[model samples]
Target: MNTPPSPPGAERTDGSSVRIGVLAPLTRPGWAEAGRHLLAGLELAVGEVNGAGGIGGRPLQLLVRDTAADPRKAAAAVDELAGLGVAALAGEYHSVVARAAATRADALGLPFLCSSAVLDALTEQPTRWVARLSPPQSRGWQLYADFLLGAGHRRIAVAAQPSVYWASGARILRDHLAPRGGTVIDLDMGALTPTAVCDELVDRRATALLLLVGHPEPAVSIVQSVRRDQRLTESLIGAPAGQPEFAEWATSLGDDGAAIPFLRYLPERLSPLGARVGAALRERLPEAPSFVAFEGYDTITVLADVLRSHGPDRALTADSWPHVAVEGTRGRIQFSRTPGISVWQWAEAPVQVVDRDPAAPDRFRILHAG
Candidate 1:
């Protein structure tokens, strides 16, 4: 929606190119860094697909729209893309933006293969039109909860911003942690400054502080305050939304960013295919690729396979989720109906609780895996 609307009846494929619409947060308030890496992987895959004879010799094309983390922008982009007659849709990083795009794509009967958004309630009801490649937020956050308990963190505080995604993550942490003698508290980032957050941690005697807030502004500020506060020296800090996964976090905070654990969708060891993709992504990106970039590559890989199998028919592409058995950059990709998740889900995407090493800020240390 941040971009201009496509011309009326814009260039639908006619044995020329097989187009797929891509929705990514590429501008302000959209985590543009992640978007850059995601697009790198997606474009890389598209080139590779074209190299290997794309969709009966038609090149795969991407009509990318920038959502900028806005739901309305995403909805508009979905309408515009559907109007352009794309064979399928792919790629979105933010859960809320992807949710909006999914709702519109479903009503219009367009097949969407979501890349990186992990919210559990992607749709209000089960629908075949949408399928996701990321692990659900509940599943990933619960694994984080287990990691906390295993590390002897009982009193945890979450610095949360006002958003459905952050709220869902905090709820998942609470629901999973409370029965096992753990307590969760929320510090409103809207009302509290970074120094105030440090004071609250000291006053509440919290053993761990989880950032459910946005990055570089409040997240970076909060980490600086907490790390500097001598009163809470023993307290652990975490970011379950994976803010620490990017290079910007390290650039802004340096060694202060180390040891702040977060959820990442990657295995302990890369498979042969994964290693090859990682090397290619590092060449394409300014920094080593995060799991998000792998997610982007895998998204296009699965879509290209599906398109090759089903051949550009929209309804048939939507129906093909359950039958997809392609190998992804992380693992084998497939979709199934998960209880309460109203879309086809990749139930086996790997997740790890990892952090930067204090000694080497550029390196990641995997603490736990699930």
Candidate 2:
């Protein structure tokens, strides 16, 4: 006989706890390490909120579902979580997965505070039901572009898989660099082997290589090949999607993963609150936490504040995006309608271009900040 399935997230029948549904990539192909850190931040914030009296003493609880980086899985999770009576929804690390969850949450009229996905067009149409803490892709990638140009790179090549996020990053670089006498060559990772990528780099004379692909497979292979290539010795490798932010990259590639500048949302100095949370997150996670963990903490903090000031009613919580004024681990958190973005975005989340020290893989060095 098959084991019975566990009922999702609707654990409290008496309505004593205010539930917030969490969507994350906790399994394979979903960047599980990032998911772990994101969950850590969310869990930490919930504990603190409960300790301080949660949502007017009712307590806040998280019902987490693993999206595993699948858009369809995330959409289905939104439906299930909304039906299970969550007051709000939060947490997703992958851009495409978050987009799916945001669309579904908007359709169901469930309030969603997106934690980490930065896709600019989160929803096809603007809706008050979703707010985001991360900076949009366009802004972050353009800043990454600025960093490349500042470092005297003009001829660039991107090794990319078939992904909207990858395509968008390539497009952003091409658009930003074209007018400034810079050129971008796109290499299809689906067709090109890692050696082929190095060969293409040599033939094309591209000075820089960007990895706009997934982690640990193609990305790792490509980096190893490029690092070992004698011809591409002087070329630079980059990952603007923040692939090197996690410890796994360092563990997987060692010094090969270091010095590959990527975009990260962080200030030069952590706030007093950020400092405190950083210590707490360090204790919670086995490895040092990424900015994603901070994003997760800030997500619950904002949602808890919304519930306290407005109420747990979904409509009011959705409408409360404009009134959120919490001090997040990153910086002051607030949202507004950006011109092209379809959701309320935290307009002032910090952005930086950083890379690990080749000498000390555990230490990050800020190359550029904006």
The top-ranked prediction according to lDDT is 1
Model 1: CA > 4 A from native: 4-15
Whole-model lDDT per candidate:
0.92, 0.91
Give candidates' CA RMSD values in order: 2.3, 2.3
Worst 10-residue lDDT window for candidate 2 reads 1-10
Residue-wise C-alpha lDDT for candidate 2, range 96-210, written one tens digit per residue? 9999999999999999999999988899999999999999999999898888899999999999899888887798889999998899998999899999999999999899999
What are the per-model numbers of colliding residue pairs? 0, 0
Superposed model 2: Cα runs more than 4 Å off? 1-10
Quote model 1's TM-score: 0.97
TM-score of every candidate: 0.97, 0.97
Report the Cα lDDT for residue 84, model 1.
Answer: 80
lDDT of 1 by residue, 22-115 (tens): 8988888999888887888898899899899988898888888888989999999899888888899999999999999999999999999999
How many clashes in candidate 1? 0
